[model samples]
Target chain A: MKSIAIIIKKELRRFFTDRRLLISVFMPGIMIYLLYSLIGNFLFSTPQSQEYKIAVQNPSATFQTVLDGYMQSEEVKDTYSLTVIESDGQAEEKKKELENKELDLLVIFSADFDEKLALYMQGVKPEQLPVMQVYYNALEQSSQSIYTIVTTLYDAMESSLANVFEVAGGNVATESDGFAYMLSTILPMLIMVFLFQGSMMMTPESIAGEKERGTFATMLVTPVSRSAIAVGKIIALSLVASLSGLSSFLGVIFSLPKMAGMSMSGLNIAYGFGDYLLLFANIIVLEMLFVALVSVISAYAHSIKEATAYSTVLMIVVMLVGMVSMVGTLPSALWVYFIPVFNAVVVINQIVTFSVSALGVALTIVANLVCVALLVLLLAKMFNNENIIFGK
Target chain B: MEEILRAEHLRKTFKISAKQRKIERTEERCKVAVNDVSFSAYRGEVFGLLGPNGAGKTTTLRILSTLIGADSGDAIVCGCSVRKQPEEVRKHIGFMTSELKLESFFTPSYLFDFFSELHGVPKEKAMQRKQELFRKFGIDRFAEVKVGDLSTGMKQKASLVISIVQDPELIIFDEPTNGLDVLTAKVVTDFLIELKNMGKSIILSTHIFSLAEKICDRIGIIVDGNMIKEDTLAAITEKRSLEEEFFALYAQIKGENL
Candidate 1:
């Protein structure tokens, strides 16, 4: 145990004292936070306030009332300023303005449109009921948006005039459920990737780099047992990876609300302290599994470069599994929780969404520990293998 | 004399990959690295295994040091069997070789303490030994410098100091002076004599004939993984110079005139 402590201390000192390594450990989190914030600001910022220019050949008071009623909503009230211009035998010129995007919309309402519409609703149909022509440039985003809004209002007005039945919809999910659903989908993939990346940052260089430089043989010639070396390295590396994972976790958590265009204050936070405890416990165990497995792969490699190449393949595999599991339905089977990476991802997803079973969590933690033990054992055995250590 | 180490028919073999086979232009799948090689060293004596490169000198020392396993034999170091109790054997011996390199990032002082802790030396004893060895090897002036920054000779000195941090009874050095300048080579040769005088059993492997004559009490000539001769330096040179005798034996083994 003392020897293991010594090894752990040395490994951690190597990581923490090196400025380059320290930067690598913290850079992922900082970069993620900045990039995600920039994306959120660009993709989900509130619609910009703008004015819409409309040319109406024959302006209708009824249509104006419809637009006014729709604009009363708080979200749209301050977003758009409306202007009405008479066509006055310049319809072609107005179209030219619309084409150039100088005009937002052109509405040509027939004379006596309200009267004809009233007559039509009273079952006295006129020769060709009053018509309205709507034209706007599709090439301009603002013009397209206002055109859609205006057409939607007209459709509603037509539906109300000849209404036989009404349809309405409401979301049954609470605000907290919405937030949880988003987290359950996104955090698993990101966290799994971040945890893997964190392990990759240290394990290959620590194990395989030692081998390449011939230092591993020096360690082997000592009286320390191989298992002690393996355990010490895994524990120390897992601690480092955990720090990185935590950084990324914070970045994700703090940036998520901004990305979704929702105020974090508006969120109905559903997770309790116990939920977080379970999540973090599983995460730490999962990192151990990752570190152990990477150490084994690294021990098999002759150089750090080779180890990194092999580990990149494993990283891709991890990413594919995480991404697929994120979109697929969660498995409730007890045996599913006994798988390694997949199990941890599922358990984390369930924990965030508040549907995790006690048995699943227990099985996942047990499975991760078992896998870690097996991989560490394999690593120790590899350390003892002369060919793997000395072979070209 | 008390026996410090014994080897009975120690052997090791390696599998040649297809690429290596092509490079060497050989059809054999396996190359015997050490074939029925056996020799012994006594306490308070420096034993030399004299051979050209690829004569299995390093491999034999590696097996005895417990860095590798023998295929069908055993070596006992300080009364511990390398085959069965390698960890125990390692505790009884100190091994140094070109293959065992210190981490470049570590200073000699830090590495000394690290290896000393690994060898389970008491803290106070380790500190005293570090001061003595560092000063003796002239490594004290650069003890705080990283291994990578040290000159080749300085690095070798540091490695030598670290190898015996446990003060083991037996010390096995593979090619101790293979890559040193004349001054550093003499320093190392003098150090071996000093170690021998202090009652430590030393195993030295080298190809230099003069090195064998200078300090070795006994010499074993290994050629093609076989121990061709083992005797006191005086007995081996009684009939001819060590170099002339070595070539005569080599001709006899290869069935050619030299």
Candidate 2:
């Protein structure tokens, strides 16, 4: 225990005391925050929160009665205005304005007699539904709002024709499920990436750097067991990497609201504290796996620079495996949980989406820790090899 | 003098890859680094292994220090088998080599405490010994400065102080005065004499004939991984000048290699 503590203390001192290393550890999180903010500002600034404009052609008396009933609410009045124009030329002028971003929407209805609708209502089926053309530029936010508002008013039309939508069965997707799906896909992939990055930043220096600078030989000459040294470093590096991963995670989580604009409400996460506990537990295991794997690469490498290069290839491979689970598609087999980093990533996705099974989560944690143990053992064995440690 | 260290027919070979050899193309290869060399040192005597560079002197010391294992055979350091009880062997040895570098980021003072703790010395005793060694070696003057930022001599003194933190029964110094300025070299030589007087079994490997003559009670001349001669300084220098005899032996070995 004393030997392990001494080793961990020395490693932490080297890691925390270097200002350049401190910056490198924090840089990924800061960059992620800036990137998320920039994307949110660019795409969803909610341009010009203005009232809607709707142009209507000739309308039937029945439609007018329905519209009046739908527009009785005061909030509806403040958000939208109906301008009914009978002349084709005038409606065409409004359609042109809609395209130019001046008007919000244009609604054109075919010339209709009330007798034609009455006949159709009396079990007389028409070959086609009455023509209604709704025009709005999808790019403009106000136009989109107008489309949604006008469509909502015409929901009365759907109620009149009960056979149309039929509004059947429970919806498989909740309104919040969209946000959960997004979180599940994006965060796990990013978590895998940032965890790897954080571990890579320190492992190469802690292991390979020591070997290169000849400090490792001195440490080896001590009475401390090689396994003790390897275990101490693995735990210490895992902690530092976990800290870095958490920083980036918080940056992305906090910036998600800003990135999503008014729809940030979707991200409110119905997840309770238990889900967060599961998420954090998975992250801790993942950090251990990553630190162990990177330490192996560092041990294999002759120098810190070579270790960094080797770790890049490892990161790319891990990210690729992590990407495989990014879509949150159910695995083809339960045995997929046996694969190391990929299984952890899938488990993270499951946790975020609130779709994880207790059995599957347990399997993932066990498999990941198994990998970490194997890697640490391998590193200890490598430390005993003079050629590997002193080859450079 | 009691026998404190003995190495019996220790051997080590390394496999070099083509990429490591920097050749365009080649098969895997092996190089014999240490070839069945053996020597012994007593409880209170300085034994020197005199050799040219690449003559496996460092490899022999590394084996005795238990930094590496011998391919075959073993060394007994202070009654501990290097192969079977390496950790025990290491606990009784203090080794300073070109390969055991002080971490540059730490101050000499921090490293002193750090290495002392690593050596398992109790804190109070560790500090007392650290102060004594630091003051003795003049390392206290720059003890607070980072080792990397210190002058070469200061770093060397700091390194030596850290090496002997446990005050082991056996001391191995490989080319102890290799890269020091004259003043620093003299300091190291003097310090080594002091260590010898304290009754530690010391093994110093060096190619400088004078360093071997001045400090070593017994010297072994090694060439091409072979120990050609071993004797007391007086017995070895009896017939001819040490330098002339060394050149004649070196020329014959060079001719054989060619």
**Candidate 2 deviant stretches above 4 angstroms:** A49-175, A262-268, B19-28, B180-184, B252-258
Candidate 1 stretches with Cα past 4 Å from truth are A56-63, A69-73, A77-99, A106-141, A151-163, A266-268, B179-194
Per-residue lDDT tens digits for candidate 2, residues A1-392, read 99999989988888889999888888888888899888988897535535677778876676566656755655454345778997989988998899899888888877764555666778676666666778999989888876776677777665675564466588688657766777777777788898898798789988999998999898898888999899999999998999888888888887776676635566676988888888898899999999999899999998999999999998999888778766548583689788888888778888887788878878889999999999989999999998787775
Error of 1 at A116 (Å): 5.8
- Could you give the interface RMSD of each candidate, to one decimal? 0.8, 0.9
Best by lDDT: 1
lDDT of 1: 0.88
- Model 2: lDDT of residue B230: 76
Q: Model 2's lDDT to the true fold? A: 0.83
TM-score of chain A of 2: 0.71
Clashes of each: 0, 0
lDDT of 1 by residue, A162-275 (tens): 887877798999777888888888888888899998898899999999999989899988999999999999999999999998888888888888788777763448788889
**In the order shown, what is each candidate's alpha-carbon RMSD?**
2.8, 5.0
Clashing pairs in 1: none
